[model samples]
Target chain A: MNMTTRVSRLRGDRVTLAHGGGGRAMRDLIEEVFTDVFRPPGREDQARLTSEALQEAGAQLAFTTDGYVVTPVEFPGGDIGKLAVCGTVNDLAVGGARPLWLSASFIIEEGCEIALLRRIAATMAAEAEAAGVRIVTGDTKVVEKGGCDTLFVTTSGVGAIPPGRDIAAVNIRPGDVAIVNGVLGDHGATILAARGDLALSTPIESDCAALGHLMEDVIAAAPGMRAARDLTRGGLASALNEMAAEAGVTVELSDEALPIRPEVRGMCEILGLDPLYLANEGRAVLFVPEAQAEAALAAMRARPEGEGAAVVGRAVTAGRIPVVTKTAFGGTRIVDMLVGEQLPRIC
Target chain B: MNMTTRVSRLRGDRVTLAHGGGGRAMRDLIEEVFTDVFRPPGREDQARLTSEALQEAGAQLAFTTDGYVVTPVEFPGGDIGKLAVCGTVNDLAVGGARPLWLSASFIIEEGCEIALLRRIAATMAAEAEAAGVRIVTGDTKVVEKGGCDTLFVTTSGVGAIPPGRDIAAVNIRPGDVAIVNGVLGDHGATILAARGDLALSTPIESDCAALGHLMEDVIAAAPGMRAARDLTRGGLASALNEMAAEAGVTVELSDEALPIRPEVRGMCEILGLDPLYLANEGRAVLFVPEAQAEAALAAMRARPEGEGAAVVGRAVTAGRIPVVTKTAFGGTRIVDMLVGEQLPRIC
Candidate 1:
């Protein structure tokens, strides 16, 4: 397959309705911008994949999907393409699966710059390569101007879970220790400032990184890991509350022990917002047996993506509230699920 | 697991930004509308799947994806949700895979009615059940009112292909028989009329149907099937051209043998369009060895979705033109790929 010849066939600087019409133009754009970078095996309608892990006796297939419509398609640390890949990878990784294959579908509004699309595709290719996942199959659709924002991406992934790896919120025990991989709210804070809606500028960049490798290491260190959840939309507060409810226990967080950057904290205070509820793309909370807490933290700290790992909380017997935080001021406060929109399109 | 209480928590008449904010509103909407209908096994970030087919010694996994942004959101025969499900299923079916699991991601515009969303979700549920595939995992994002049209759906699917079933265009050989399951251009014609831009009205409905069972039956009958392609975006002409190019053979279509409705033909003539270039969602082109062509046709005719199946063309020795049509007027003409948009967002 001579990609050069195929890519040379593209004749436009911007996307038009023709690029999504299932015609020559559409083929040219897809082959040049996507397949050229991803290099899928065949031109077949579906990608045919084979993996030894899939044939394992008790391997379970893990499937996940996410739609990315973040405002300002490109941000300081990452673009929507990067988020699309990392978000789906984390969804599978947090489930105790070895992330493998991804499928990306793009919905582009007419008149979007072709160069921008190429950049997004390139970022996706780079992210997939870094995470050791193959982008196998995809689709593209074009809508008239005003039919959609510049572009939106939806990525779906499939992975394999080894036998006896039963990771779920219900498996969390009362004595389980909750650990976080990094500082919270970096992504949310960056996006809020990037949007320029509040005229507040900060040097924060999105903490958007793939956690597959970090997760694999943590599981290896803590063989009895109970559950893990990515701190995406709704941040740490929502995740802790859900985990507590599922296990019918209470999660108590130590405010001082929680890893939060001063810049993020300052931004939260100025906006009268709770940092715990701000989103983070690269952070996740893991529950492990109390004995393995140190080992889990050590494993996480050994990785660049988890260098800020810390123990923030622990599960206790059922109480009046599912989650509570012990404040630095020597008082405990209930932390409940967010009731309304705090930050839309934070992801 | 008691869905009644979860559903009772929803409190809204229309979708707001909060429903997508990863808060209580988002949880209520997802649980009541999507999870309740799809019934994914667990609340984990990913769906854990296990299948005996996946464990077969030499089986391969088939993956495909598609994004649907058809205008009007609803047409006579289907809505965006139905198209989202069937489009991905046919993509896998054409690859000779037994479609099994699908993940649907939705990009919704704010201010959309909750009642309409329920209708769309219900339609997707019904379609997946009929296709014998599970809606295993999904994600939803909401944008501001002008960020997108009412809604767009992207569906990615995985299936299993038994060993030695290498159905691909490159496998096609000269003298292979070509067949189509049903009418061409019904979907395109229906959408055009439904758009109300041409001041035309017709009883024509979109031919949106899942062909997984039909493909399975045909494969069983004709074990020597060469290749199959869903006649979607660019219709039969484009599919035939692609197959011909891949196999280095010439495809000759008999104009009189094509299964086209009178309404579609009339509409095409009035609008200066070619029926061969119009899209069909429920139709597919299949190639099989001459010996098993009769069995393949018989198997297709036995199914309701393929009752209108007919032999329409054949592959011949390589020629100057990859695709040509034998007109009823006793002359042959080149059938080139569509150069520009005939119909956008038809699917």
Candidate 2:
């Protein structure tokens, strides 16, 4: 395979208007980069499944969507493709559903390399396979050369929940414990370094991964799990605050218990950024009953995606502040929702 | 309400970085333009219903996704928002499902006008309501000024079909009768004029309408329905050829029976373009048994979207060509898929 992970026998290295024209060229592009990698066995139109997708299997479905615009397309450890697929699958998993199907839509600029697109699709297919989900259908469109930066991908997922299961943000209980699956700020820090805006050097890699398998274990272990969330754009801080406020309680975090890599912490310190608000692609937060907290933590730590699991906080019955933190100095401070991140286009 | 429709008391006319931040500005933009127009009754945290969307009643569903990037976000009859909703809805409708829920994801440039976005959302909400579907979940992301065009919207839809229902392109039978729902080439002609690329003075309007309601009636009436397709990008020519090739039969069309608007024909004649290859936003060609063709035509013509319905073609048992036409001049001509569409971003 080439560096971009595909044999290029099509047209130019860059995408042309014909690639999106709904003709022979469009069909060939879809087949080469998308269908060849994403399709399972015994599928006629792998890229789209336009006709076969019409078949229906009876099941109650959970549907969700997310758009990934992370610049540099290629980050330290993962590219936009991995983020798009894993992100949507995790969204459905955290919603208490077994994600079964996905639809990937790509909006590519006229000048993007075909090889890069194929590599992205390969990454997405691999991630989907690992997550035990299928990219059943997809669409592709190419715009004029300067009409877009490079590419943007949107993955919308559908999943089915068991009859007795119900998961939502407002299910938080007073004595629930907050647990994080893995290290935080690695994705944000890696994207920052990849942009070369700070000119810093570090081998910090993004924690981009699909958490479906880990979530299945946690859910099975902690039968009393109240709520769960995957921290993406707004990171762990935003997630905890939303859950606390919805349940009419205050969530208190132990600053020293947060799972942060020393490298990510140093990077944040040098940049004057809070690790609490930094994004982590592969991390999730779960609210489990106090009785099941230990089991939940153990189950999370058993998986590769959750090797850095930690119990970070506790939920208080009544308080005005939605989220608060007890620092290493024996002082308490509020962790409000992030107002704005100067870094744009970071997924 | 001014020409833009709703009361706008937000910040600047053009969207800023704050509009996308996970803070007060982002919340306000979402509330004013998105939720206020899209939501049903009482709902907390109007920005996202991540958990609420998890509750689904057991039913078979059909899921699909499509992206709309037409130049001139607004055309003579519809905007990108309408196209995004209707296009995805029609895709599911053609697949023999009653469209139910949709996810709208927007990638906006930094400086696009907020009023324009609000109007577009209103249009989408209206269309979704007309199609008897709900915009249950949505997402918005902002990019740098030159990172994208004004905006790109991807709508992913999920629908359901009762047991014993099945639809596929390969279901086309040799003796099937072909039917079209609306005037051909109007959408393409209108888009060409909207771009002002040809400077034509045609008054043609795009046939951009949701066909789910019409499809329901047709499916209900035609018990022996074989297959159906919506002519969006490559138009009727591509759809007919695909069905014929899929079923290993020959499609024969009568030029005199094909429906066409006078203005659209004149415009196409002036531009040396073929109507059969032009795009249509609100058209579907169906294959039905000869005994049920009349019932299908009557059901289609009963709806506004199918007012210009016509029985334009038939499927032959065997022939070398997949699609052929008997011309008005008493001659036969081959109707092959266009190698490339001159109208690149028309849809």
* Most accurate candidate by TM-score: 1
> Candidate 2: deviation at residue A193, Å?
0.5
lDDT of 1 by residue, B167-277 (tens): 999999999999999989899899999999899999999999999999999999999999999999999999999999999999999989999999899989999999999
| Residue-by-residue lDDT tens digits, candidate 2, A200-230 | 8889999999988888899899988888888
The ten-residue window of minimal lDDT in model 2 chain A covers A45-54
Q: For residues A233-286, could you state the per-residue lDDT of candidate 1 as single tens digits? A: 999999998888998999999999998899999999999999999999999999
Interface RMSD of each: 0.7, 5.0
Best by lDDT: 1
Candidate 1's C-alpha lDDT? 0.93
